[model samples]
Target: MREVFQAELKSIGDELIQMSKLVAEAMERAYASFETADTDIAQEVIAADQRIDYLQNSLDERAIDVLALQGPVASDLRMIVGSLRMSASLERMGDLARHIAQLTRLRYPNQVAPARLVDTFKEMARLDIKIAHKVTQLLETRDLTIASEIIALNTSVDKLHASVFRAVAEAEWAESAPVTADATLTSRYFERYADHGVSVARKVNYLVTGEWDPELSAALDQD
Candidate 1:
């Protein structure tokens, strides 16, 4: 019975890793579509979100079953609870990517970011993609160092998000109202995506260390 329970736990961990990889891919493709105004790729990302959602539901059911049947305690219990939290964050990340793709689709021929703010949005997208991949690595390796790196990347993304607002608020800003709205919404999606990555990293840190680091908590609070 004990061996079987251990196997079940390992299965749950494997599922989380799979979800992470899918999220990274979704973000990559979403950005590609956003960068080029490729509706087809954006459609692909929007459809792919369903798969991530399915995985989250399936993983949650399995975790609940383990809790009901095996009655995990101590570290085992922590693993189950933490897995649930991470899965929720991963699912939200997938949704954020879908939101980005949807915005691209809505704008069609026109680009989402105005010419003046294009470089800023591009940088934010780049950071978001990096943060997603780093999240996958952190889940696979459980290396606390990777979690720290994820937090740092998220910090940079936050700065970029703020810069977008500043640009929009300037008196010289000449973009139309629609462009301004798109900029605000798209920048927010990128910022929230990175924020979810940080949330997952915090959960992983707690799972590994058995206690949350004060510095990590502070960084997330600043978000």
Candidate 2:
């Protein structure tokens, strides 16, 4: 029974890594569609979110079954609980990617970011994609160093997100209201996506260290 329980725990960890890979793919395609105004790729990203959602649900159910049947205690209980939280964050990351793709689809042939802000949004997208990939690596390796890198990238994303709002607020801003709206929303989507990456990283940190870092918690609270 103990061996079977350990196998179940490992399976849950494997599922999390799988979810992280899907999220990374979604963000990559979402950014591609956003940058090029490719509705087809955007549609693909939107469609793929369902699979991410399904994985989250399946992982959660399996977790509950383990809790009910095995009655995990101490560290095992923490792992299962932490898995549930990490899965929730991963699912939210997928939704944020889909939101980016949806915004691209809504704008159609027109680019989402205005010309003045395109570079900024591009940088944000780049960081977000990198963070997603790093998040997958963190989960797979459980390397706290990777988690720290993810948190640092998320900080950069927050700075970019603020810069977008500042640009929109400038009196010299000449973009149409719709363009402004799209820029604001798209910047937010990228920021939140990075934030969720930090969240998963934090959970992984906690699971590995058996204690949450106050500094990481404060970083998230500031956002």
Global local distance difference test of model 1: 0.91
- The whole-model lDDT of each prediction reads 0.91, 0.91
Q: Write the per-residue lDDT of candidate 2 for residues 21-138, one digit (tens) a residue.
A: 9998999999999989999999999999999999999999999999999999998999999999999999999999999999999989888888898899889989988998999899
Question: Model 1 residue 199 lDDT?
Answer: 89
Assess every candidate by TM-score. 0.96, 0.97
Please provide, for model 1 over 142-206, each residue's C-alpha lDDT reduced to its tens digit, 9 standing for 90 to 100: 99999999989988988988888899889999999999999999999999989888988989999
TM-score of 1: 0.96
lDDT, candidate 1, at 125: 84
RMSD to the true structure for each prediction, in A, is 1.1, 1.0
